[model samples]
Target: MPTLEVNFLGYRIKSPILVASGPASHDVKQIPIAQEMGAGGVVLKTVVSDKFDYMRYWPRPRYKLIDWDKKMNGKSQYFTLYSYEQAYSGSIEDYFKFVKISKSTSNIMIIGSAFADEPKDWIYLAKGIEEAGADAIELDISSPHKPGTMQFETHFIQAIKSVVENVKIPVLVKLAPGPDVLHQAKVCKELGADAVTLCNRLRGLEIDVESQKPILHGYYAGVGGPWAKYYNFKHVSEVYNEVGITISATSGVLNWIDALKYIMLGATTVQVLSAIIVNGWETIRQINEGILNFMIEKGIEDLEKIRGVAARNLVEPDLIVRWSGEKKSGPRNVFDDW
Candidate 1:
């Protein structure tokens, strides 16, 4: 009733709530249920260049995530047991088929999440997704797990440029949180991306110190928790401060407060995972309802009004005037003698 429509490139979504790219969006059957549960849109689990790998398995292509804490809803690290490039992802036939079906009925857009082997492969992936009838293509450049799975900001610019060049449809570059995020967004915009999904899973590790074994089959995984909320907001604020880019805020968006904080920090939409895994899919409706009610109470009608309201509130050396704050001591440059 609150009219929560938002933009995904040129396309329109019923609300700002989206399912983050994960195990939840593997096949066609899950699509209907996700929509019924009030998902504004659902990004398909990343499609890699290796269509042969996907062909070996049907709708239930399986991957495992390591529990950092090994506790449900507890502190954890999630890494794809199996990984590949998402841009040129999956069997082209099945990827196209999923897109065609998802966009047919519901207002929810089918965003194909793609990772490619190299720059040349991006255009094929983007054009393929657009031709396949997806509303948009989400280039997953920021994800921690890929064929090489290297540091995020380092390779992001090249990845964005390649994807934006190849596709005529709206291209969304998912970026990780870091000092370089603002520059990365500018690069995406300059290269002609429509939107930016912020803060990919942060790198973290879990060791079985007792057994002296590694918990994850991979070296490290992305960290997720209730604690990630503030970090997400900070990253979003930085992007909003530097320029206006359509942002999909991610990480630990667990409550209405966390969602509102992101909106105030200029996120166009908020994606969730850990909460849905913990509470249930119905949480979307509740989150939507809560956000809508708060907006009305605070005199917010549209999504843009609250974007970056907290940008000026960010902590900076210039902003802190308190004399009681951490006082500077003498420089410990004793190594100068060496």
Candidate 2:
């Protein structure tokens, strides 16, 4: 059988599929469920600093699913999710407890995630998570809904560097998807981040034509769906080609094929969230099985064989070999003459 085991940041994991740091990992019970469902690991929901007020945005969280068919039937697959949500509401102490419990109860890796306003707070949480026995720390600096709390680019790099300096465990920076992603990943790698999650949701707005209002709480919210997978693949491949850092590919992975695309683009692991929210936990098992079957059929024995193979072949458009002699016998479009 092909081995799915991966050595990520000096730690071995049974599989490359990880439950992303979101609603699926928000509760302690959910962590174990993901483990039982055949996930390789779970990134706990982002825990904020003690001074951060959770109650202010706790009244009523909003989320909506937009389907192409408009009927919203089970058979229809494509969807766009619009959500207005914030960081984890629980206290840091409680988050520590959750990490400890997950570690004791499951063999799968447990990654503690955190985000805070101050650099000192980032260090404090990273230390606490390390002491709590988390396998790694995922620094969440990419939530699109929470803009005010996000640090400036320079400050973000400084915070990551400080956390990496203070923690003995591996630190992974979760970055937002944008033109600056490649630069951000390069900075994190230079500052000693062991790995980087390629992306989080993009900020977007949807308007209701008749009501003249926004679909999600009248504010721009985090947007994601199957359509975003193309962008995810493009960015992940580009980052791998340029920065050459270990990547935990996140956002827009909805199936095993999507996961495979990430691995082929040099990601050490693939994180899933929107798929689980749309489908169910069984999606994890199905994806794992699909990968295993595909490997068996392809005569491949290890993930390393395919990792970054496509990226190695990527070349600039101008460098592509082209046929100098033209004028084939095929019919041409009217625009070709113009």
Candidate 3:
């Protein structure tokens, strides 16, 4: 069998499929479930400091699924999710326990995730997570539901530098998607981040036109789904072409093919969330098997053969020649032309 192993941030992962930090990884017990389902790693839900408010308005954590058809019973080929779920509510100590226990019991990588109210709290939590025996630490600075988080963009490099300095394990930053993604990726590399997750959810809002109000507690929410894949792929490819930072592509993977597209665009691994939420953990094995089967059929021995191949050869848009052919004229009706 062709080897499916991949090297990510000095650690060897069994596969390039990792469960993203979200509801699939909200509980410690879910880690083993992900492992059993063939995931190579799991980023635990964002562990916030005690002072960070975890509560949401009544009827919070709501979701509206946009389907290909109006009836909403169609396939998820065009699925899109708009949601307003907050970060993890439990204390840091509780998350530490989860990481420690999960590391002991499962062979898959247990990446501890943290986001705090203050920059100092980030360092404190990073130290605690490293000590708890996590395989790596993911600094979640991209959560849209948390206000005042992205406002620290000016200090992001400094904050990431502090965590990288404090932690013994690899440090990765989960960045928000925007025009600044390439800039942020370069900054993270210069600041010593071992890897950069391409993005979290984009902040968006939906209107119930009849009610003349916003959906989900009448506030802007984070949005993602299958439709977002191409956008994420473009960013991943652009960042790889620019700085070549180790990238964990997230936000729009729904199947093995989607995962392959990200890998081709230079993603070290593809973190899946919306797919698992809709299809369950079995999708993990399905993705893995699909990749393995494709590799064997193509006589591909390793993922490196295809990673970033497309990005490396990408042509500049400005260099392309535009079509200037005259429009063809035809008779108004087929019978008249005959």
Candidate 4:
């Protein structure tokens, strides 16, 4: 029988489908549930430094499912998960306790996540997470909801470097999905980061046209949906080919197919959040079973065999073959003039 196991950050995890660090993973109670449901690992909810303690308290109605009524083939699988939630909603000490209890209760790999503005705080949080027995640490410097004026070059670069130098456990840096992903991924590799989570949610605003105002907290919120996987896929592919670093894909994973797409495009692990929150925890088991079934159908024994296959085969834009258009046709397609 084929297995879903894969090695990430020098640790063998049961599956590549990790529960992303969001509402599903913010509480210690969710850890055992994730493990029981067949998650490879879980990036614990990000603990923020006291400098951004305001993120701890969320609005009364922070989540809104946009385009929920729109459906295709009788399924509403596409929708934007708009929310204003940030940080672990707990004290830093409480976060350490949460990680410790999670590690004790579940055998699943626990990757601690944290956000801070200062390199010293990053080092301090990483050390505390390591002491709490986390398998790895992910620096969440790319959160769409991050406050203040912290730039990657000035703030996050030093934070990543400091944390990597200080932490004994593997360190993963999470970056935003933007044009600079390739450059940032290379920087992470040079800084000795064990892995890079390709892309976090984007900062977006939804409008309540009826009221002529923004929706959900009346401010720009972290937004992601099934459509997000495509850009993240591109990020993973580019980072894999150019930077050659371990990639943990996050954002827009709605099902096993989405997870498999990330794996094929060079992500060693795929972190999922919106799907679980929109669907249920059973989505974890479903994703694992789906991958196994696919492997059996294809007679593939290991994930490594297919990892980065799609990325390696990416056709350069200059080499793309286009129709000569010697034979003209009516407006059947826009490429008739090509």
What is the lDDT for 296 in model 3? 95
RMSD of each: 5.6, 3.0, 4.3, 2.8
Ranking by lDDT: 4, 2, 3, 1
Clashes of each: 11, 0, 0, 0
Per-candidate TM vs. native?
A: 0.81, 0.92, 0.91, 0.95
TM-score of 4: 0.95
Sort by TM-score, top down from the best: 4, 2, 3, 1
lDDT of 2 by residue, 49-119 (tens): 87666622542557888774553345545688888777776778888998999899899999999887678
lDDT of each: 0.71, 0.86, 0.85, 0.91
Which residue pairs come into collision in candidate 4? Answer: none
Clashing pairs in 2: none
**lDDT per residue, candidate 4, 179-231, as tens digits?**
59999999999999999998999999989779999986888999899988888
Higher-scoring candidate on TM-score, 1 or 3: 3
Which residue pairs collide in model 3, if any? none
- Candidate 3 or 1, higher lDDT: 3
- Put down candidate 3 lDDT per residue, 74-192, tens digits, no spaces: 66567678887776657678878888998998999989998875668888889889989999999888887767535546656677978988888999899888868988899899889
Better of 1 and 4 by TM-score: 4
